[model samples]
Structures are given as structure tokens and as C-alpha cells.
Target: MSAPLEFTLLHPANLTEAVKQMQAHPNARLLAGGTDLVPNLRRGIGAPDTVIALGGIDTLNSITETASHVEIGAGVTLAGLLASNLPTRFPALQAAAEIASPSIRQAATIGGNLCLDTRCRFYNQSQWWRKANQFCLKLDGDTCHVAPKGKRCHATFSGDLAPALLVLGAEIRVENAQGGRWQPLAQLYNEDGLDHLTLAKGDLLVAVRFPTSETRRSGYLKSRVRRAGDFPLAGVAVALTRTGDKITDLRVAATGTNSAPLLFDDFADVIGQPLSDAALTQINKRIGQAIKPMRTTNQPGLYRRQMVAALSKRLISTLYEQGAN
Candidate 1:
């Protein structure tokens, strides 16, 4: 890959200034931890005329707690999140925050991870390679290689934290030129590979709020070709609360197998059911049904679905055991 194309970089000292810069240059891509954007730049994925660097904004790096929730700033690194006592309150997030290598975790922000670009074998290649392939639906080309007759792209979203946060009932704080608003973390993403994030032009993700609870027990697990530094072939996160050996609240979410992080629907319907073999089988079936994996990675789509189901059952069983005892 070649060096990133030349662009003017602006450092905003405050959130207000950052928002103004983004508003002024609507096409300017944001630079947070630079873990993903920089690499994409080198790959000729985007060539923004201006880049707004958010690392200079102190507010985006703080972690604060209220009686009901804990707010983690968007710029806080994955390592920073794991270091805080907040992850102790949500083990699934803590587990997910440790993704990739130590150095990568130290530089990758939750915001960047959440807003990670959708990926596919056909799209994430170098310029010459993509050009040779004649491009894909996500970029210069009109055809979707994954489904030649279809009109949509099938790039997968591989972020590890989103599924963890999704099951924990997290909400994000979004700000733009107009002002700020809070939306459920689940609402931040859509299934489309080309435009996965629901964020509008100039919208900046400020922070995420995790609702506090005493009895929730959660954990996360991933399947990959390597033990470290590999994006998950399939990842699952489960959060549940037990009441006298019956599951009180159960939430399941997964990543790396779909265009958007998936939250298993009808999970609430199983509330109050005993965590038994039948329950596990039910969850496994739901996971198999929900995962819509395309051939974005080396692994087959059916393999990802199977691995995700197994990972989900294993994680839910473990959490249920811990919550039961």
C-alpha cells in the first residue's frame, strides 16, 4: 500500500470546536485513535480534503459515573476502558475491550471500534487489487460480488465491543451542529454493508452510557483463526440475571457474522425459563437463525453460523452457571 494521500489536519481543543469543524467540512473524516482510519487511508479507501483530529478534546477522554449509569467518553481507548472499574461492572465489555493485541487496544477507542468500517474480501484490498477486481458495490463498482444479482453489499462488521455493549443495554450520546441526543446503542447501526451506521452528516459520537445493575452476569467469547490480533470469525456476548435458578433477564448479541452487530430477538420471551439443555438448544437455534453471514472472510458462512451458535451456547451456559450460583 502507498502512503496516505495528503490532507490538512485540524485539532479541535473542545467538543464544540470539533463539531464546528465537522459541520464546515461535511466530508472530512474524523481521526480518533487512528487505528482504523489511518490504515484505510493508506489503502486509498478514502481521501478526505480535511481530517478533524479529536484526540485534543479533553472532554472526549474522560470517564465519569452517576448513580444510575457510567459514561465512557468516545475517545477513551480500549485499554483505558478495561483499566477503569466500570468494566468490572460489566464483564462482557471488559472481555471485549481486550480485543486484538495490547498495543492495538492501547490505541483503539470504543468510538472507532463501534464506527468501524464494514469489511469484505472484495472491498478491503489495495487500490491496484481492488481496481483489478473492478471494485465492489461498497466502493467504485456497481456489482456486489457476494451476491452478483443483488443490489446490496454484504460486507461484515467485525467490531468486538458492539455486541458486548448491545447486550448490556448501552446507549450512546451523539452530538452535531444542532445539539445532542441520546439513542440506544442498538439503533446506532443498520444491516446495510455500505451505510451501516445510522449517524448522519456531521454527527459525532460523544460517549456511551451503560445502565448499572447489581445482578447482571455477562461474558464474551470469539472464534478466530489465531488466538491474538485476528478479527473474530464469529463472536458472541451474553448478559443475564438469574432469579432463583430461573433466568430473569437474558440478552444475546453477536458480531463478525453479519453486516451489523446482531441482537437476538425474542430473548425476552424466554425470561423466567430455567437454564437447561432445552434452553440452550433454543438459544442455539435462535442464533443459527439470526446470523446472516456472507462470504466476507475466509471462513464459510455456514462455518461462522455454526461457530457463533456454539460460542453463544457456551457463553450463555457459563454466565447462567455463574449467575445461578
Candidate 2:
């Protein structure tokens, strides 16, 4: 039988206190909604000596908007954001949030989703199941079952909001014992699954900021096996601006297709061109080539790759049509 899990829970009064607590407990795990961490804790995936709960920090749960951008605190619930004017301001984000079930949305926070753990078919099993299979590289063992001879882990990132935020050019604010720094959300991830987030020890995700413009038309599309409560098999998020049917600005990003959410900078070649059939064909081809899908989910890698191409095409085409009308 496995030993029972045990940990001390710390509730900091505010962001400042939270940082101090995190610094003091270097080996602690931050808990926002406990949706992901609790389950992982039970399975012994992360057995921290302390669990710091950020839910008590009020400032981290508010949303503030400026003329240039919208700042969403890390503690803001998915349901809270969806209920706010964010839906009208950033419809694509709202659509992505709605993809999760209403129950999860009610309890899951934006920060938790952004900092979700990398998942693999071989790694997410229960303790007994994993032990029986001799454990993969992400856990206790040395061999990577997914890529036996490979040097690194292949667990796939499965965040829903990351691609949408990335296409919007979102910035993340992280705080630690020394101070805080704001960086492009794209820089916060690494392709390696074992050490996926680029955050330093004791660094806490504070908020997410992204520019908002009436001229931008955006959309998010996800492919999943089930209609609800399933992490995306593959997903795409797109934002673009058009002037009289000529594309002026374009950003494309994808998630659930790789170890980290990816920004398809190669799609920039489509800028200044209309969304014509030929142009879309070229863009779709680029997307198919750019995404590196792995067999981390129940679906095959080939099917996920195809879905990425199809979803990218659909999102871009839908946004173009909507912008035209």
C-alpha cells in the first residue's frame, strides 16, 4: 500500500505575503484552485512539503482594464472571466474558456490553466499503474517510453487558454523574493516536458496582460474526442487585422500539438495578402508542417496533426468571413 499524502497549507493574506511564503518554503507547490494540483498530489506526482494557497490573496482575483490592454489577475476564475466584459472584448478567449466544462470553469483559475502540467499517456496514470509499467522519464525512471532513445521527455502540453493568449501577444507577470518581471507569455514555456515552465524557484505567476483592439478579429478552435471535459486533441488560435480585404496584421498559435504551445511566426508570410483560397492553402500547409504532434493522448499523432491543419484553416477562414461582414 502507498503511504498517505501529507502537507502543510499556507494561506497568505496578499500578494506580498504570498511571495514571502514562497521564498521561505522553496520546495512548496503553489495552489490556486487545487483542480490540478490536488489530483496530482494524490497520485504522488508532486509531493511538496508545503502547499501555498493563493486564493486568499484578493488582489490576484481582480480584473483591471486600461486603454491599451486588459490585465487579468492570476486568481481570476475561468467562469469569472467568461462572465465579465472579457467575452465582448476578447471573444476568442471566451470561446476557449467555454470549451472546459461549467464545473471546471467554476473552480479552475486562469493562472492554473496557463501553468498546467505537461501530460503524457505514459505519465498520467495512477501510482500503481505507473509502477507496474516501470515508470517513464517524467517520473521515477530514466527511459522515455514515448521515445526510448530520445534524450528528453515527450509529454504534451494540454492548456486551452495558452494558444489564445499567445496569438493575442499576451505578457505574463511573475513575482519572486527579489521582485517581479513581465515577459511575453511565449517565453514562459520550454519544449521539454520535465521542466516545462521557465519560472524560477519561488516565482509566482501574478497576472496576464494583453493588448485589445476593436480592429482585430480573432477566433479559437479546438479539436477534442468528447464534446466536453476533454483536453484538446489539437487547438489553434488566430488574430488578424484587415483593411479593405487586405490583411494588415496576423498572428497564429497552436497548443495540444507539442510539448509547449507554439507561435507560428512562419505564418507572417501571409500578411499583406487577402485570405484567398491559394493563400489559405499555403497557410494550411505551413501550419501542418510547423506543428509537431505526438502520441500523448488517446488519439494518434497523425490524426492530431491533421486536426491541427483543419482547425487552423477553419479558424482563419471564419475570422476572415466575420471581418468581411
Candidate maximizing lDDT: 1
What are the TM-scores, per candidate, against the unseen true structure? 0.97, 0.96
TM-score for candidate 1: 0.97
Candidate 1 versus truth, CA RMSD in Å, comes to: 1.3
The C-alpha RMSD of each candidate to the native structure, in angstroms, is 1.3, 1.7
Compose the digit string of candidate 1's lDDT tens values, residues 1-325: 8777999999999999999999899999999999889988899898899999999988999888877887889999999988888677678886545488999999899899999999998888898999999888899889998999999988999999998888888999999999999999999999999999999999999999887654478889999898888888889988888888899888889999889999874765568888888888877887787789999998899999989878888888888777563
lDDT of each: 0.88, 0.85
User: Per-residue alpha-carbon lDDT of model 2 for 1-325, expressed as tens digits?
Assistant: 2464888999999988999998899999999988888778778787888999999999999999888888999999999988898867676686546456889888899999999999999888789989999998899999998889998998999888998888878999999989989999999999998999999888999999998554478778888878888888888888877777877777788889888999875656678788888888888788777677877888899999988888878888888877652
Off by over 4 Å in 2: 1-4
Best by TM-score: 1
> Lowest summed lDDT over 10 consecutive residues: which window, candidate 1?
89-98
